[model samples]
Target: MVKRRDVRNRLLRLFVGVLLIAACSAQAAEMGGKSDARILIDISGSMKQNDPQNLRRPALRMLVGLLPEDARAGVWTFGQYVNMLIPLGQVDAAWKNKARAEAGNIASPGQFTNIEDVIKRSIADWEGSATLYQRHLILLTDGMVDISKNTKKNAASRQYILEQLLPKLQSHDAQVHTIALSERADHELMRTLSRETGGWYEQVNDAEHLQRVFLRIFEKVGRPDTVPLKDNKFLVDSSIQEVTLLVFRKESAEPTQVITPSGTQFDAKSAPQNVSWHRDIGYDLLTISHPETGEWRIQAAMDPDNRVIVVTDLKMRSSQLPSRFVLGEVLPVTVSFTNQGKQITRKDFLDVVNLKSCHTDSNGTGEARPIFDDGQDGDKAAGDGEFTLQVGQGLAAGKVELVILAQGKTFQREQRQLFELADPIPMQVTSTDEGETKVRVQPDAELVDLESLEIKAALVSQAGEEQPVMLLPSAEAGVLETSIATQELLGDWTLSISATGQTRSGTELDLTLDPVRVRGTATPPADPPEEVVEKTPEVQEPAVEPATMQAPLADEPATEEDNSTFQVALFGGINLLLIILVVLAIWIMRRRKQEPEFQLVEEDDQLVEEATAK
Candidate 1:
């Protein structure tokens, strides 16, 4: 009888441990919960030019250190092949230490970019559809798929990644956030990955910006609860057990220091027993345990990237927002407060709370916009403990952050979401057989009223000469077209484009487009580069980007075609991810199980290796 009792106790303990592990991993997720992230970085020879100083090292370190204890993550670097740079495991002090130490080995020596392999190996153990963990894959690359020098084989592999690999990841509800580190990087491919998988995509022309980008990705993945920093100070409520200050420092600035609620000042050198300080290349990450419940001040230079995150019982719950979007997209965001695990929904107690959308655009300027619980604007229903607002009006395309700040009579809580806004228009430049350059524009019929659209186009010569063009409706119903006399033009000519349009709802639009350049054919034309006075935007092509892939938001319900594909993020909201509907998600899970499973390539020493060997 004694032996049997002991056996029963041991089994119970084992079952409890299994449950704890399951709880630690997920996808319920209200926005910004525990994280399960897989990181894929490129280390091909091209990095020698793109990241000569290896800023990826410090950037990776910052991400690893900021990961809370509940997160599960791993890092893989790919080039000639894929290598698990750091093994996937639950995040803890030991995991962080190992990850940070291994980061020093990040170097650009690989021969090719085997993006396909790295992605496969990273998520080999991930299975099932519905779960508790929000799955995210961060892919950083500066080039296209190049598994081999054979151009056809490389193209096939890239195709496989899109056709075969993407569906499998989508089936598992994984979001792939991508970073293109150089202008030469495959922006189209990265954009497709982000768009199809509900991941965020960013293009960083310079490697120096990797750390900042990584920080934003961390905000999306980790979703750390935070206290708003006002004028270099933040207030910690009684519910906050720990607070972390991530302060960016200027090269000539004094070391960052903080003053606690007790009026005690502490710097990295003189931090108290409960404080942990990690000062990195351009910023400082400091955490304090059992923080006093009061306002805290930072004695350092003020920067927008600076933040104060907390481990707290009181949380400002928010609607999940996608981290990537285009201009002309209006995003609805909602927020509420929770104490411990239950929501604080008393109208009398909540009526006095001030909820705001604090914005920082590409220019690094700050703006505060009010959100209300009055059941108007984009708010579905109001005053039921939910406050709502819609943003993306009069906002430029670039890196942005929307800080959801809620301040009540006694407590202050904030959540930060970072996103990249893509240009609404995609310009395509191609030379006609006649040596003329054609520019096409086919706006999304669903988003824009075709009749009210006006597109302006100009051909800019390398020598700074511009020739304006006129646009007219094409034969097709919703297409616009124009042709530029580029036959006589000598060097590369850049197409400068700007537009004015009105949505079907009659809202005026001002749009910006990137410069699209095509080389001259070397054949002399009837008109000289400077002499050609006129050109117009045209609709020689139906879609610069696939029309079918245009992301459909919740406000705009999808047709059967859209619903057929597993679309919509499970948790994403403001600029967030993950908002999977219960019944619909289960349906998707059933449908996904019927599709053929993707098989990873068999392991080979030359094709795969551990980073430890390097």
Candidate 2:
């Protein structure tokens, strides 16, 4: 009974093991999902030598045996050149047969190595046979270029081949897988090339591990993930390297056949070969290989004038964007677009992308939206369109970005522009004299190559009246000096200037005007000249005054009466003089009234006596 229990327990363990194996297999299959592992074995001369770890073991033999029977298999070998030793086929029947056929021919020592040619041919075969699905190219090299027989210089042929072929293959969208058998095999170059082409690179210390490494590679390459076109086509652009072209109908998935006028027939997977001008519809496809691993360009070119629409290239220059500018400056971003494509009257638009701190924030950082239309002749029916943009405030000063998107598939373009902003640059203009109403400005240091800078000044008076002054730089051999003179005025004036200089970044300066004051007092008119007075002479009564005065006083009663009578007689005689004097006064008054007015005469007494005697 114990023996029976032991047998049952063993059976249960075996059953569990089988179940576990089945579950693991199912899980792997689910993850891989109908993607067969496509393995590329590099059966170069180096593979023939036995590695130290796997004694008497050839790396290629071990790798071939280890590949799963369900996987797709191919063999490639290069000595003086490369050959597709095993055409891609099911691993069951022809796989072993083809592997055996290629095994003996794999090792070709003491022969030249044309790596570029071998890669080109391999790419051609893969593309021609449509074996690129789940495809990988395994490169195993022991040493460097030996293509002496193919060209005058040993490395020339490889360089020529790379120049001719890499780009063509790249444009065709070929991915690469590379392996270095030893460090001597231009490994750095190979690794770079593979990585650039979106392939993986590995270093092999011993050939014995080649088989397992390949298995891992298959596992990685077989996984299906969406590869971005931009990454794959990195080498395809002119600015990029190791890129090629694969010509195809723009709307079709299949590559177009390349037929050169020189009667050269190249597989679309070859390098981006030169074009042959012809009256017919033949074309060429080119593949460009990247300097880095697996990076390349694949592009297709056609000779058919109708299908090959060669448009003019797009060119652009904007005066508004300086090397540096302050935040929220409305620079004159002028853009000009030209048509370079064969197509005529093609309409397109220019899109401006704003940046903050040199970073693109798709949702603009500020409320200011671009007010300009996308292209020339765009609708501007609304009169207030200029006010629509909500520009952000206080953007950090640095590099700004502007992206122009080309519209209209058929159009090619070139453009340039000059622009000005309606808004003034914000700055405080303080002046020493509050009364000074005029301002002038110029570059502190003259800008050498610049023709001029656009400058504008704003003045704010003490009364709160804001005034703007615009000045164009004078065309002379010196600092750009522009002057703004104000009307005769009082009150503190603020002078601020803003400008875009050719050599200078957007700049602003401020100053204040001082108040002016007047000086000094007034005097009285001169006094009129003074009038003169005349004096009359006294009579002889002074001679008898002392003696007669006393005697007359003593006899004053009676004698004084007699004297008074005599004096009365004398005074009566004096009455005549008085009468005369009255007559003369009357005459004088009459003369004054009747005749022209004369100055009062101071007469001599003799003249008066003469006049009285008369």
Candidate 3:
């Protein structure tokens, strides 16, 4: 009996354990795939004109459809302000209907693009809510921050987004994927935000491509493991280190064929000795070490959804150039390329490398091709991938992105380096009481090639009047000075200096000074012309003889007029006293009336009597 009981208990325990495991697996399967996403839509005024078709509405609706029912999402629109149209909530029929309606109603255009505020709000929302879903932010913008109007504020906004908000998003494990809707968008900033947060940046030039980009984002979020590899062809260049093909299918095993550059076919079932492959339940990973340089095609019989990834063996390295540069200065850049730990020394391969400098500013973009340095112009050696870039008169003061594109027989690679060019010469204006206005130009000795320095100055007034001023080179090494006459220092004048050398640089200074006063010549009062003292004759007043007047004594004051005056004075005094007494009496009566009547009554006469009796 004891043995039987023990067997029954063991069986029951095993059955219960099985049921618990199944329940947990089902729960995990239900919860694991759900995602949390926030969609940021740019509704700035520029978007209305730039995106004429209003493709964002449809794209947003499609995104809503793509989200699974278990997912949670929210929508926000930003301009000068940010508005949350749909708070983060579970995606259901009701939620979808409301989200779509609100998204469709976002037709009104806004004034400015306040991207930083929306990003902050999104981060706050995500941090405030605790969930197990993977977090994502889909930021789409048609215009950059409105820096033209308030540059300082806009710059601060950008800084806050990068410095303060980006880290918070990172700590929260939220990825920010950015979509640039038009050419005017700040693509560099958008790319930085996405790349730093392990997300992708997509640029959609036309409204028609909006849907496709949105779909791609959806795929990335929903089915991240699925690689779209159908009908994909990859060029395997000599620089490539390894080529990997991932085939994802529903079948247990599928035949995958890879055609090499020399028309050699390799099958997954009979892969060559050089090929490394792994087979799993529903996927296959095929890798070729040091793939040959040629066109390679991959095809799977069962799974059309596959992906080919190419890893280059080429090791490219570049250093961060000085963030600041003086205008008219030469920028020397060195790039090195290596393959499989060996430096590529082929002359033809080095010749195919091209460096493109793209300088962008508020005005526009300027591009230039830099030449390879061969032991000339500050370059120490040649053919080692050292190039010197000269920013000359044509390029304005702005940020520059240096792009290096190197192409081999079958592959091409690109790398970008960024730097900024600043005006080399510093300018200032000074004025003196002597009616002389002086303009000074100081060049950066380190960056300015003084041998080729040429400086020009002009005084521009507020009324758009410009007067050319001659620059007088100072005895100092890198100083240029110019003076303007007091007469020309009219209403606010700006001293504009244009310096040209290996590069061209210019700066403008407003010349505001106190009015110059001209001293008037004072002739001595001519010695007052020996001022003649004119004496005026004074008329003497005739002396008049004083007459004696009789005065009344104190005893003679009993006259009738005096008596009458005294009586009148006495009567007025009496009346004044009487009026004072009357006013005092009235005041006393009013005060008494305001006071409450004090009635001394016996308090609880019965109790007092009882106590007394006790």
462-553: candidate 2 lDDT, tens digit per residue: 66776765654446433233333333434456555555544334343222222222110113357988987676685665554221232233
Pairing residues by index, what is the TM-score of model 3? 0.35
Q: Show model 3 residue runs off by greater than 4 Å.
A: 1-32, 128-131, 224-614
Q: Which 10-residue span in candidate 3 carries the lowest summed lDDT?
A: 507-516
Which is the leading candidate under lDDT?
Answer: 1
Clashes of each: 37, 86, 3
TM-score to true structure, per model: 0.67, 0.28, 0.35
Q: Rate the local accuracy (lDDT) of all candidates.
A: 0.81, 0.42, 0.66
Residue 435 shift from truth in candidate 3, angstroms: 61
- For 37-124, candidate 1 gives per-residue lDDT tens digits of 9999899999999999999998999999888988899999999888889999999989998999999999999999998899888888
Superposition error at 604 for model 3 (Å): 99
Ranking by lDDT: 1, 3, 2
